[model samples]
Structure formats: C-alpha cells, structure tokens
Target: MADEYRPEFIRRKFTITESLDEVLKQMADRYYQGNVSLCLRASIESYREILEGEGYMATRRIERQLENLVDEQRTLLMEITSVRSGLQESHRESADGQQLTEPSMTNEMVRIIELLKTTGDGLEFGDLVEQLDLGMHKVQPALGRLVDRGVVTRTGEDGERFTLAGFSQHYLRSGP
Candidate 1:
C-alpha cells in the first residue's frame, strides 16, 4: 500500500521572481512521479544556499514563514482526522439496531449543537448526558434522531458516541 502511494519528487531550479505559490504548485504537480523525500532534500539544500547568499535577515524571515506553513498544515491534518473519525463512526452505525427517532431537536440537543459549533469539538456521551440532565436511554435515542437527520455524526468506534456533523453549520448559522 505504501509503495503504491509513493510520491515522486522532481528536482528543479527556481528563478528569482518565482512566487512560493508557483513553486508549491510545481512541486505538487511533480510529487506523484518518484521519491519525494530525495526531491525535498535537494530543494531544501538549494534553498539554503540561496538564503545564505541573500543574508541572515531574509533567511530568518523565510524560516518564520516555513514554520507558519507547517503549523497550518498540522492544524488542517488534525481537523481532517477528526472529520474522518466522525464519518467512520456514522458509517458503522448504519447497521446498528439503534436509530435516531426524535420528532424534533430537543432544547438539550440544540444546546449541545451550539456548544459543539462554538468549540469545534464534540462532547463525550457521558458528559453530554450529565450536562443535559438526561438518562442514557433518552439521550441515545435523541442522538440517533439527530444523526439520522444528518445534523449530528458519531465519532467513536462504538456507535454510542457522536459529534455534530458539518451539516450543523446550517443550524449554527440559521438557528433551530
């Protein structure tokens, strides 16, 4: 599987006027043809030489920009993992006996959705039940209903845990 997905990195020289966006686009275009690690190593060495000749101030600025880019990439990766987990859980529940059947969003579910939207994180089942002052049985059914409507999505390997799906954007932006 790993071998099948290996990205090909290409070696190329950058002109003085080329923008970072252009470089990245070129890199992406060539990344699927061979060993990306070698390509990146070569690119970094070239960049280092360029920066050294340019001076310390430019080097430091580029380093800072690279750090910011790395941080942004890390954040996006984390969010993708979270969303994938939620979708996985939702898929698992497709075969489960329990299904969401609440007639309408309860005030508690409304509150839970609001909290998740504001924080961009889902609550654990125990925490949600406690917060809403509801029994597990009641909360489970209500959550199932919300999941069925595509407003909430589960996130754990077990079907019992859930998160607000991206569709909750509608509820958050438009209100109940």
Candidate 2:
C-alpha cells in the first residue's frame, strides 16, 4: 500500500546517436550542473528568450499603427471645426437677410431693427455706435437708410433719440 501511494514522476525516452549523446553530455557538464534535467531547463529558457524578442517587435509595430490612427483623428477634428465656423458665419448673414421685408436690406439695417425693438425709448447716436460695434461713419448711413424706409423714427428737438417705427401709439401712451 505504501509503495502504491508513492508520488509518481513522468519518465521520458529519447533516441540519439552515440556522438550526439557525447555532445549533449559535454554541454550538460559545462552549463547545467552535469544534470540532464538542468540541460532541458536551459534549452527551454533559451527558447523563451527568442520568442520574447520577436514579440517585442510585434508590439512596436502595433504601437506605430495606434499613433497613426490618433493623428488621423486629430486632423478630422480640426477640419470639422473649420467647416463649422464658416457655416455659422454664412448662417448669420442669411438669417439677418430673412428679417428684412426687402432683399436689398443691408446687414446694418438688420442690426438697427434688432436694436431698436429692444429699447423702450430708442437709442442715441452714441448708444447705436457702441452697441452696433460700428463707427459713426457706418452707423449714420444705416440710420439714414432706416429713416428713408420708414423703419425708424428720430425724436427730440435735437433728434438725439431714435426709436422703432410702427409702435407710436404704444410708445406715446407709455412716454417719459
């Protein structure tokens, strides 16, 4: 019972010529503590080293591929941003054009209408200049156009205030 219960080790058999056996024995003696088991362990270690060196090259190739993909993504993102900026500018122009009764209405005219509708008592020349982000040269011309179109009204003895047109009844009742 004790003999049958002993731990077992697998045994292997190999066939080799007498000359090859001598060479293996010498190699085992030189590097493997003169033991055949140590000789097999050394061979396995050498194979592992070779496989790992090859795997490192494969890993480097995969890293380069990933880097190229990231660069492509960055380029795509920049193009999208540029296209969006241009679209927004054109859309703003088109939207302003739609606000006018006539297609001949300029960007300045659209700005005046939008500004006038927001203020209760209208705006002065200086206020229009500041809010419109334009100079006196540009603002005066646009205001003139609006007056001619009956789209704006100039008030006060000095004509200092400017208000929207078509709201006279409401403005007069809510005055001062």
Candidate 2 runs further than 4 Å off:
1-101, 168-176
Instruction: Give lDDT tens digits, candidate 2, residues 23-113.
Output: 7799899987799766876776777866879657767889999999999999999999999997565434232223333457788878887
Clashes of 1: 4
Please, what is the TM-score per model?
A: 0.32, 0.39
- Which pairs clash in model 1? 8-31, 8-34, 100-144, 100-145
Return the TM-score for candidate 2, rounded to 2 decimals.
0.39
Model 1, CA-based lDDT: 0.65
Taken over the whole model, the C-alpha lDDT of each candidate is: 0.65, 0.76
Model 1, 62-141: lDDT tens digits are: 99999999999999999999999976665443222122223355766665655556433467788888877888888777
